[model samples]
Target: MSIEEDRAVQAAQDTVVRETDNGYRVLGSPEESVTHQHDIDRIPQFDVTQEMVSGSGENQEAWLTYGGNYEMHRYTTADVIGPDNVNDLEVEYDISVGSGSSMEGSPVIVPGDPTVMYQSNGPNHIKAIDARNGDVLWSYTYAVPSDVVLCCDDNNRGPAVWQDKVYMTTLDSGVVALNRYTGEEEWYTSTADHERGYSATWAPIVHDGTIYTGSAGGEYGVRGFHTAIDAETGEQKWFTRTCPEEEFVGDSINQAAGTNWMTATYDEERDVLYMPVGNPGPDFDGSVRPGPNRNTCGTLCIDAETGERLWFHQESPHDVWDYDSASPRMLIRDLEFDHRDEVRDTVVNAGKTGWAYSMDAETGQLITRSDPGVQQLNMFSMIPHIDDGRRGTFMPGGMGGCDWHPATYNHETGLVYYKMHNNAQEAWWRFEEFEEGRKYWGGILEDETEAMPDEYNGHISSISAFDPTTGKLVWRDWIDSDTYLWGGTMSTTTGLMFAGTQNGQFIAYDAETGERLWEFDTGDAPLSSSPISWYDPDEGKQYIAIQVGGSGWLRRGKRDDRVVVFSLAE
Candidate 1:
């Protein structure tokens, strides 16, 4: 069939799938997904690489199977913990691993087993924990030469477990697959050259038989990209560079080059993998890489098997405020859009602009836009959000429209949740200055002094929910804070939304009403890691997990590092 014909057909199928009880609806019917009979017989197929269940069959839980749905995004679909009973939540386990940078990780539960694997920052390492009691079953640390130059926080976002093997990326640029039962290394491969300021902190996404991962090195002058590695053999399947060769080079020379520093999601029905890339190098300077930087600072969907680019959408072009496109993209269907008939398969991406852009997953067309309740647009404009907000905008001050942290999708209500801030900072141009051996430039390059806008106002940061189809605000819960907001979001099938903050609090809210359900003081800042949900087969109780660590970018200082888990009192 022609491409247009295929899109039209897919659009129709999407309407049927979404309107009826389809797979992976955040708050939709799980029983319907299991009952519907479809043409594809491979419905039970597991996305071992991305953790998404692909294949045609009535039984595959593609929507709720893995991370984003249950697979790569690591957000949960089980809603055992909700507003009515969230106050019953108590700290079940707290693991203190000395101290680290950003302990950004989500709990990956091995279906039908009590095993859940997670990771930690600072010297990238992986830990297998017993879900019932939080016992460390196995721990593997990949050694980086301690001196590698990394651009952002030194953290391992988490690991993916497939076919009894736990897969994770290291800060030193190595991808390792370990035995789930035993921490023995199964296979390993290097993702990038550490000497050139390239490293891997993203969690490995496994779908089918491939492991998909990206790099982290926009600040120190490194071009970024994403790759698919053979899950069983740890061999390279294919690689897609985020920053395609510049169409033309300019005199200023500072270019946006980094891409694929964050985790990605997969749409099994279409055999497509969606990846979000990061910012360009000299992050604040746009003179080097001009124009809407294609492939970089945008979302790229590829044919999962062939690694061929099907569609690319740029979220930020010439990103002058360090707004990297490396955030999570949630896949959903039956989303209603303005001027469009029926619901369409959609991808919801959270941006550092404090806006959530909804687009047709099959066509890359804009569906809707949303603001995260943050209070800054002038700063975004000053950083050159000038190109009609097409190519990246520095507005809202890129500290986060939503950073690399993950968001949650409730299939029940078709709402995706995330945390955002109202931050504005003025950065003056800094000539290439050698800090020890690392490159040091102002946040965004400007010759003269730029007056940083006052971020001090009514609490401007919030946790928001979006209607992916119409791009309408479902609900948003705000918090009073002096500093810009950080951390991430998660949702459950049972109707709860979880999040953390730089202000030292982990919050639980009503997924439908945005009401504060429960709150806990972690006594430390949680700047990066968002909360994750898992089911305890043994205790039959649902649990929430998060890593509490401080980010220099958020607090302008240091804080403690630890992982905390909560569950209903036994």
Candidate 2:
């Protein structure tokens, strides 16, 4: 829609700018869109310590950190709203964020008697909601530049709450800190030059006093790097360049556009950071850069204190297919090995290469590569070495496999649950020079939905249960063969897995078995974001919340920002 059209729509008094389940619609004003809690003081003090954030998802009372508890587990100990009662789940309250974009980030529940929820929208809008009721506590929206270039949508995975402030990365390459007590801007630190195509769409992973975040825009030829900033003062502690010495493809790959866009899980035990780095510049056409790109498509183990490179693992060498290890890496604490008798801890990561790779936590070693999680056709074939420029189609395309959506590990089942895109893309290579702040891909690729291989199902996406210990796929559930499962998954101790679908159904499946136990239609919005569960002891009820509203969760759908939450039907 054009700006004039948007203004004309906004000018309409009857236009529903925001709508909640209780029929709270901002028919007149956009400022009233952010409903603040009247009894804000009754909530609690803005005091979330490092200890509380570290012990997140364990207490079953609050969800303090992303990845649940730094392991990126996305698992909750809360089992109140599980299997049997899951079918009786109904909407608790629904709050609309705005009409800008959908919700891609998880909601963080601050630890308190009556917890408050923090959510991030695609366009850098952060909101605080009263968990007890659906009252909007407060909201802080960062002013993103209209001209700034973003690799994907204007989405932030979520925010990191520590001390007295809430931290979030911006689409305009910014790290903004806001006062947790009242939605006020505390500080804004620039991570990279946004005009040069540098952005930070991932959530800032917060540690003791430092917050670690990465840069986006690998497609724009900007050199990839992650920074450590002081959580309180917004001071950059250290920055690590991906390929400072041209380590991977030697001199052939001069442009170091290996962006570390996702949030890296921290092994607080070893004081090491395991981050997944993305694809290098010019995604296709690896001829310009000869040798296999080393650190680009793999996991990088770094010293948490000093930002020093400890070890690295490259999944797809010379990743011409854009098979980036872009999915967030997780630290599996007690992973029992299938071949080796020893019970060694490993860092598990889902890849776009349609496989799950787990490496030794202390020493980065290929522990196991899970069986194919998605369809793989013409896997790793060279782009027809002909002078004539013609596009070649390939399965497990750029958007194939587990692209970006985080996987949850079930301790009971001992399997990883993640989404898979069985897609085909028509990719062609060309020689294009790196132009600053521009699309520098020496090639181009597009989704080829009309024509796919015979083995390809009619489904656009599916979810898989991968056995990380043995490198095998236990089950692949194509819940809806028609729509995509854009939203990610999260698990509970009750052996129940929670996820949302592109068809607007918030679903629950048996983690051990691929059985669809329950589902709820969340209207026209696509539930592209993952569902998070936290037990509220005050209400004596468990709540499951998800932000549903995004067009390009892979396919364009109705765009509405609604934070729909659920609990057992009273």
Candidate 3:
């Protein structure tokens, strides 16, 4: 179907469903009208080059990389608004970006031009807005298949900008580039076929002249891969499969699922790109897929120029649990550890197994593994007996120890901050044959009530700070929610930690002491994405921004889809 026809169908479907006060509503169509464009002369356009993005760690004007920098630290040096005056922070501007199923994208401000920011919503809708005021400049929508099978919600992480163009992946497994000034499409290319259960949900990263991205369909038994494309022409430069072909285990190519569903980090000096691979196919039942899955459930480092696999360190080998190492890998350089004599460069990642791992970036060797961040009862236990209708309880259920939320690293204190939840689930299985384009899992995960009492129903969620060098916990604070804390965390140079909760509170904590500093209620909606901060030169103020909307686990009532920016009240 053409793009226009698909949009018309979506609009027609939206008319039949209405949002109620209690939160239940069908998916709505994209906004037809665009926000009136502001005077272009007032906004300055800055050249966003590869060098600028590489050195984005010190960036105070704009957030270029997905994790706020190339190292994926999610830390900012801007300290104009610190803990001293954070209580005075108030909403500066809040603009609705249309009502959608989910809003997971992180807003990226134009380089040197903090007045302009770019964002994307669920269903692949892109928009450019005046950062100072909440006025949309231009918007673009991509056609989506009506019957796409997604294990999660229809979501897009965000976009990558280089030079004068913005690049993003479509819900139907296609990549497109757009003019940053005007939302006109420059080029588009199909990354994979949607019918085969291949999709792209995470943000793509652009370095030099190449754009890098990965596929997302491990739940559908899709053979995952990483692709590099020419940023200028949208031409395929190289493609490397996450699952190695030499190791023929379990249904071979068809059942080997090592999808990359999270944003990757790039090492400019080493010319290596680190990609996080998801779980193998048939998450609960891995009997058919035998042998230690080669590259799945691990971090794969590859040569950026040639797409060659440099090395891989598997976090979970021959896994029975759905412990995907899909979190963003934070690269820390010149790390001195108490255990080791030599200073080594390390990459740290949090896995669903409720453990944090730090590995040598160059050789993929295990540097250290921290104590369990969450409950680990029945962890690594054998798959439950499925001959009868009995169910078994498993800790750190499919939702994850640390899902796709990007963890943050604070350079000032040499500490890593991440959110984790302890939600044990009951599982039982029924063998089934694999079918094309269908959920190919060999069994089902059923709830086991007899295993635990009703009072123990709610999950425990907490935010933890740890030292990766010694695998020691620095501080831990439990949240007041039974639901998982799915949002990302951000640390600032002024010793402040920020994170949004599933219950709609955007919170700030004292980084050193884990004390609650300040919080703002975001309409009681889930802030599933990360929080970002940038300094606005024109106003001499530092603004913190985050996307607030409904997410997969917390979507029940009327939802609000908008980006909220906060700054100290004048």
What's the CA error at residue 168 for candidate 1, in Å? 1.3
lDDT of each: 0.61, 0.76, 0.77
> How far in Å is the alpha carbon of 145 misplaced in model 3?
2.4
Off by over 4 Å in 2: 1-39, 248-254, 384-389, 479-483, 553-556
Better of 1 and 2 by lDDT: 2
- Mark the regions of model 1 whose C-alpha exceeds 4 Å error after superposition: 1-75, 111-113, 250-256, 379-395, 430-460, 482-484, 554-558
Tens digit of per-residue lDDT, candidate 1, span 1-570: 121232212221222111111111111111111111112121122334432343211111212232545223444545567667889899988876443545666555553344343444544555555555666554545544534555555566677767657777866677877766656667779887766666777777676678888777666666667788988899998986665565436522233455677777877688788888776666665554557666766788878887787887777666667666666788776666656776787888887767788878898877677755466556445443333332322345556667776777776767788777655544433335423324533344321224434444555477788876666777776766555566568777667777887677887788888888888998745555766666655677776777777654434234555778888743
* CA lDDT, candidate 1, residue 218: 65
lDDT by residue for model 2 (499-520), tens: 8877787879999987989988
> Candidate 3 residues 377-495, lDDT tens each?
76676667588755667777765688787999987889899998667766655565766666765555543335653434355677888889988878887766545577689999988
TM-score of each: 0.80, 0.91, 0.91
Q: Which ten residues in a row have the lowest lDDT in candidate 3?
A: 16-25
Give per-candidate clash totals: 45, 2, 2
Question: For model 1, what is the error of residue 306's alpha carbon versus the real structure, in angstroms, after optimal superposition?
Answer: 2.5
Query: Where is model 1 poorest over a 10-residue stretch in terms of lDDT?
Result: 17-26
Candidate 2: RMSD to truth? 5.7
Q: Against the correct fold, how does model 1 do in TM-score?
A: 0.80
Give the residue spans of candidate 3 off by over 4 A.
Answer: 1-43, 446-459, 553-558
